[model samples]
Target: MALNIVIMAAGKGTRMKSTAPKVLHKLAGRSLLAHVLGTAEQLQAQRTVVIVGHGAELVEASAPGPGRQFVRQEPQLGTGHAVQHLNGDVPLIRAATARALIEACGGERLALLTIALPDPTGYGRILRQGQRVLGIVEHKDATPEQHALREVYTGMMAAPTAWLKRAVARLKNDNAQREYYLTDIVAMAAADGVPVVASQATDETEVLGVNSPAQLAELERRVQRAQADTLMEAGVRLADPARFDVRGELICGSDVEIDVGCVFEGRVSVGSNVRIGAYCVIANASIADGAVIHPFTHIDGEKLGVQIGAGALIGPFARLRPGAQLGDEVHIGNFVEVKNSTLAKGAKANHLAYLGDATVGERVNYGAGSITANYDGANKHRTVIGNDVHVGSNCVLVAPITLGDGATIGGGSTLAKDAPAAACEDEEALSTTSAARHRSSHARALSCGLRSR
Candidate 1:
């Protein structure tokens, strides 16, 4: 059967006190309208009709595209009146339109999405006669017994398209508020002897309408909890799910461990056996298998995302910006920042360095405090380091330059032009610093070599 979704979203939401439409307000990195459309699509809704008003264009754009269509509700009417604006805009849902919709959707089953809230104030209360629904009583007109009933109707429904069409036709606005209430359709449906079925989901957050900043915040927490729970169920260890915030989509592999104070912003993927340390903020990035992102790493991939290769070690205060691509076993240590740069396999930028707009070669040892001066006042440039290069501390390799293979850059050397890394090799270090080369590859101690004056 072809399922169709009708989203009623024409309210001004005066309590929100903002210019933007209430449905446009976001909960989990996506607009509330987007969330509704997504859920409806998941239910295999063949067509979605969004009733738009109050920045109608913005609301229409926020809803899902392709199969979705929009209808305008002008003059800012009440719920029933807003729906009445269906007019010629919607192919379905007009007076006597339900039968046409049923023919289009291959009618087999119908269900209304609703919730049962604890406090049923300001909503229409459901009136049930035995096992059948009688009608809906608005909160203002509900009797004391009806007021005590917690079961309320969220203004979302599904039925045989024909019956729905008739219900809308019979709706009235003769009330104290003088606003037409869509809930009146329930009485019509019950009176017509049409069988109406309702589907209820617990956790009122899904059906909560955002009319204020406070409600928006509450919904945000609910949405985040759902995402966090999904991640935890996927074997990703989170220190505190409540403390974590995923603003964008996060895809994680097996055994991924994320510590407290972590925020994954945009589209991010974590490979198997990955460990994201505390206070790390990652966005629009992909981390390969077995990678360890240490504490306080802030990675924002933006339009052009950052990619960290397998078995890489990053952070303790690392910032990987857009266009950063790290090869296997790359080490980006404390106070290191890489922007629009590529670090080759086994390369190490172990501490206090900036490699912006640069290309680094395999097994290159990027020294502490070493930087690629890729930006001048006028324009940005690139620096290239060839294979097996050793860059010394406090060395600044200016932009639009390249170092040859097995090259050595001297400590305190500022190379404005292309050169070899042979300036500070271990062979030269014997005569220069008179210090033995240690077992480790990276510089552990500064060899301030002097001449026997």
Candidate 2:
């Protein structure tokens, strides 16, 4: 039999008290309807149709892609009428519960996905004889005795497409609300000598619908729990699972530890033995093995991604923007911001520094309050620090410049031109305070207070 999937999304969701359609509300960073569509995609049905009503234009515009077909239900009547708008071919339900109904459907019998709830108030009671399902009686129409039944219909059903159309055609709006009831088909099927079946959902959370803000929040937590469980099962240690939020994909290796209040977005990957501290927001970055990202660090790899090498240590409050790359054993301390820069092995920028559009070489010690002045009004430039360079506190290396190997820049100095290898450049010209000193790679000390050549 050709399978067709119909999603009934025509209701205005007055209980939600919002202008946006309830199905378009977010659950786990995706619209609720999108979540339903994702499950439907797994079925690979012959045809998929979404019935839209309130906020139809917005819902259709925000919908994920091109293949889905849509029909509108103007001045929505009821659930039965919503399904009828599709002309009755395929299964019917809120998008949230489609997967269970589709999976439970054997396609030969009329199937309803039912749940056993402690409080079955306002729900349609599932009537059964022996092991066979008889019908579903809505609480408003059910007798006092039938109202006590715990198993209730979940507004989801599957049946032969032809039979479904015929049964719906015979439906009447004779109920108290004068609304067409889809549940009426269960009794119609049983009366016609057709077998009616009920399938119980394994996890009740999967069928939860978001009709209000409170309900949406609860659903978000449920989704977060699932994401956390998957990570935990893979050996990732989370300090507090409740405090973690993953808006996008997060790939983790073994022995990875994440602290409280972390939000990961846009496809981040953490390698083995990595530790991410509290309140960090990391997005689209790759953190290598043995890397430790301290508390409050922000790494956003927008367009151009950021990479942290093995054994690299970053932050207690640092920002790494696009194109920041750190080689093995590099250290970026508190309050440092790195953007479009690459720090080679053993490089250290210990505090209050900004290294943008720069290349830092091995064993370079960049002091506190130092910065690479890489942008000059209209154009951007680069600063290069060669091997074994020692940049003093509060100095600024103006871009389009370089500090050769074994160079020493004095405290509070700003350099526009390149500093020669093994040279000492001091800012204090008047106060001969032995301004700056440098020892050559051969261990020979240069004369103190020397002027620039």
Candidate 3:
């Protein structure tokens, strides 16, 4: 059977009190319309049409990809006219629920997705006569008794395309709101002797709609909790499920432990026995087996991803930017930052250092307060450190410079040129006795005072 999806996204969302379109508002890092489209894609629908109005241009431009057509609903009349058309508002609708609704339709009847909510205040009430579903009454138009009914329409339905067009054409705007209600088709279908079936949703959260900032926030929390639950069920230990968030796909191996206030985004993969500490934000990165990411670490691999090796120990406070690749047993300590660099096995940058656009060799110890000056005003360069090299504290190895095998750079040295293998390089300084220097400074100060007098 050929399935066509119509998404209504024309509402101005005055309740939201924002400039962006309501459907453009995001939940769990994706827009409401995006969620709907994702489900629609799952159905392999023949055509996906989006009816746009409020921010029509913006919405159309932001539409995920090609193959989706957009139609304008200028001076929007109501749900019926917009869709005359659509279900873009309900972002949480799952593909399975939609598939079930289609199956319930059986290509001959009207199948409306319904759910029983504890608070069905704003939704349309589902009117039923025993096994047969009669119609749906909007909350504003429904009577007191109808309002008390917990079963409500989920604003999602599957029907024969021909029957739906005929039913929509017969819809009249004689109701309280003077807008053509899409739910009115239910009563028409019942009158026409067409079987109106109800397909109950899996849960209330699956059909909840967002209309305000509070609702969006609530949905976000619900989504995060669901992700957390799934991770826990998969044997991942979360210190506080409520405090953790996964904005994108997170694939974890066995025995992974995530602490409170950790956020994983953009397709992160953690290996077995890995531990992520509290308040760490990791995106588009992969942490290998037995790696420990300490608290307050920030790793963001925007395009070129970061790779943390097996058994590596990273930061209580550190950052790993795009293109950072650390080998096995590497240690990146507090306040260290690595970008576009590759550190070989056993390399250790223990404190307050920066390694950008550099290649660090095996067993190298990058000392505290040391940095590779890889960027100049005009261009960027690379620093290469050979095997077993030691970069001393407070030293700067300006690119394009190389420290050869077994090289040792002394503390406080600022080297612009390359250093040869098995050599120790230090910045030369004029030595003076502290007492003599102090006496010379005192005599100069006395002479200056006498001259002034």
lDDT of 2 by residue, 1-453 (tens): 567877777778888899988787776666777766766676677877888888889878877465688889887777777562221211122444555565555676888888898878777899989889988888888898998898987766788788888888888889888888888888899899888877786566765556678877887787788899999999999999999999778999999999999998888999999999999999989999999999999999988999999999999899999999999999999999999999999899978999999999998989898888888898999999999888878787888888999888876677777888877775531123334434463332222222121
Instruction: Evaluate candidate 2 by giving its C-alpha RMSD to the native, one decimal.
Output: 6.1
Clash pairs, candidate 3, are none
Task: Name the best candidate (by lDDT).
Answer: 3
Summarize candidate 1's per-residue lDDT along 137-169 as a digit string, tens digits.
888988898999877876655566666676677
Whole-model lDDT, model 3: 0.87
Q: Model 3, poorest ten-residue lDDT window?
A: 429-438
**Which window of ten consecutive residues has the lowest lDDT sum in model 2?**
84-93
lDDT-based ranking, best first? 3, 2, 1
Winner on lDDT between 1 and 2 is 2
Report each candidate's C-alpha RMSD, comma-separated, in the order given: 7.4, 6.1, 7.1
Kindly report which residue pairs in candidate 1 clash with one another. 98-161, 98-162, 99-161, 99-162, 407-421, 408-421, 408-422
> For candidate 1, which ten residues in a row score worst on lDDT?
85-94
Cα distance off (Å), candidate 2, residue 31: 2.5
How displaced is residue 393 in candidate 2, in Å?
A: 3.5
What are the per-residue Cα lDDT tens digits for candidate 3 across 200-240? 98788879988899988998999999999999999999999
Error of 1 at 367 (Å): 3.3
